[model samples]
Target: MSTIKRDKGLDNTLKVMKEGYLYTTNQRNRLGADNIFETRGLGGKRVLVLSGKKAAETFYDNDKIERKGTLPKRVVNTLFGKGAIHTTTGKKHIDRKALFMSLMTEGNLKHLRELTRNHWYMNTHRMEQMDQINIYRESIILLTKVGTKWAGVQAPEEKIEEIATDMDIMIDSFRGLGTAFKGYRSSVKARRRVEDWLEDQIIQTRKGKIFPPEGTALYEFAHWEDYLGNPMDSRLCAIDLMNTFRPLIAINRFVSFGLLAMHEFPVSREKINNEDDYAYMFSQEVRRFYPFVPFLPAKAKTDFHFDGHKVDKDTMLLLDIYGTMHREDVFENPNEFRPERFLDWDGSPFDLIPQGGGDYYTNHRCAGEWMTVIIMEETMKYFAGRITYDVPEQDLRVDLNSIPGYVKSGFVIENVKENLDRR
Candidate 1:
């Protein structure tokens, strides 16, 4: 973590000053990097302002800047680092993001939209007419179908399950909650079955002309150039790109996290409407509200001072993303779900993130963030405009809780209008 200077324009400036004091001085105990820090938590003299954009910018810039080791072992190894997109920062990062945008051009988005419609027809429906609709549950398959179809990916639907199973196995490698430990082993076994299915798709895609010259994600990724040169490292980049749809499809989990925040923190709705960067603000809430990844572990490239304490190279720093969201100094009503704090009086999106902030595609932040936001806005509108589901009665009141409840609790589909009409 880099030393943060309080900046202009945030609602909770004073709280940050107090917390920073506690964190830097020894008045508070050391917050070993792994521990989850509440969004506005004030310990010691240093205040850990999880959502402090300025501090976040400093921390993101400190040391190597775009270290891509925050993901779980499998994903970090398979999809991060130099070959992956998020390792980029600065101007070059903008170029890469632009390239990604080009691929999602008018024609491409058109194709994707068509594909999404087809997918909705094929995969999603009311589980039972009487049973409540769980967009969270349906989101997995819908996102998977849309991703694969839009990317022109040559894989069967079952392979998506393999990816999910793999995620489970990886999650289990660390301590999981209760029965999840058992689920992890089962996931490992399930992955073997997935291998056979994924192999066929891989072979088929390689043999087929699925990657045409125009309008395909494969074409764009396969021909991209960077440090490796014009044709870039096609095989590696493609393999990385092939996994792109998985994250995109699985984006519903992120959407769920955001919506849950909206429902839990009604006060946040005011903030969201006030900003120019509705997309950015919503993106930030996603990063803030959800546990996208449980841990962000990284090997220190060299010795560096974090809040004045020296850490040696190869030391692992655990950046608890969820913890960062709740730090009191960075946000007002840190635990409350308020989106307006991020926006101006006008209703556009502003500073929010799911992927890391500052610069994208070339390094630290996510490449797909723009597209992700588009999808989220559409989904959010669809939900807010169409459905009126039952809010569950629980220990926490829906009126004031940070999160209303699980997707299953009082999760319902009612008062649905045109958007919710599958048929």
Candidate 2:
């Protein structure tokens, strides 16, 4: 194995912040390394950033790395609440993951799709009354309602906006230093508020004071047992429950990107129809072409070698999710927004992971990935066929430097109208 090239810097955190999603890809190219390179990041810790199919395979190998202790405390508290499934390992992680996987069944997915579609339709009436709508902001509110209802959470109608704002704050807090710190503090309070609410529901469910219907995520997770077969903690149950719904709201970013694509590539909109397959392809392309998570971090479980590079035990490794998706070696003219690329493409987990790569059941891949795709497909179809709206003149440029990117004007739409031709 060849020695890994080291980035000579006391800390590259500023560079990462400045470059955002392009940090790893730019570093690898600048160094002319194969796929792996080392750098010092945040707090001057040794960090290895890697991309491409082989590197992703190595990063996802459970025996070589672990999720625990990899993420920053700020991220843990803000983005993923404490004791979330994102922080677990081994059998504990597997058991907790199973709880989420159980809810992703085909029937449940269809139910979620219907709920999201119905909620979108319900919201469009209000949009028609307005001259313009911010799809990003509107999607967060709409999906929050869809998510809460689908999860069987009995949130009052008045609380929906509050819940959506909290979730958005949590996601936005993942970046920025002092601002992020404040957001983290607020997120902690917000998380506590949400947990307290869910804990009460869990307690009520246990005591039969209230009962969520069977097969709903809230009911199943409330009654879930850990690997030890003990009743799960109410706080952890709430964290997991929030994990389900928060990501559903986060899908708003992709929905925004999908709409932007429709505006930029008007021809692609014609491809999406009532048949979900076309929408699925368009959604896949949106995920690939747009930015979501820049990268995922993990800690080396033991000393290991990959593609002529050595990774020390406990070294922080970043799998470049954004870079991997945009790699020219894998995607032809990747920067272009093309939905048909997925129509005949072979399905490889590593090549197109806007979420995370590998088997969702075994690894740290986002459990809600299927739900995200389903929501995006339904969203695309709704915009393309079920509803009529005009994209108003606005700045639609997405700043690549922004982590969790969004359109500059949030993809504004004017003259929102329902398609009388449909239904």
Cα displacement (angstroms), candidate 1, residue 215, comes to 3.4
Question: Top TM-score: which candidate number?
Answer: 2
What is the number of residue pairs that collide in model 1? Answer: 49
What lDDT, from 0 to 1, does candidate 2 have? 0.86
Enumerate residue pairs that collide in model 2: none
Off by over 4 Å in 1: 1-55, 62-130, 155-213, 223-238, 258-287, 345-353, 388-423
lDDT of each: 0.47, 0.86
Query: Model 2, stretches more than 4 Å misplaced?
Result: 177-180, 274-276
Q: Taking the tens digit of each residue's C-alpha lDDT, what string does model 2 give over 26-138?
A: 88888997588888887888888888998889988999988887888888887888889999999988988889999988889999989988888888889999978999999
Deviation from truth (RMSD, Å), model 1: 8.9
Candidate 1 accuracy as TM-score: 0.63
lDDT for position 178 in model 1: 14
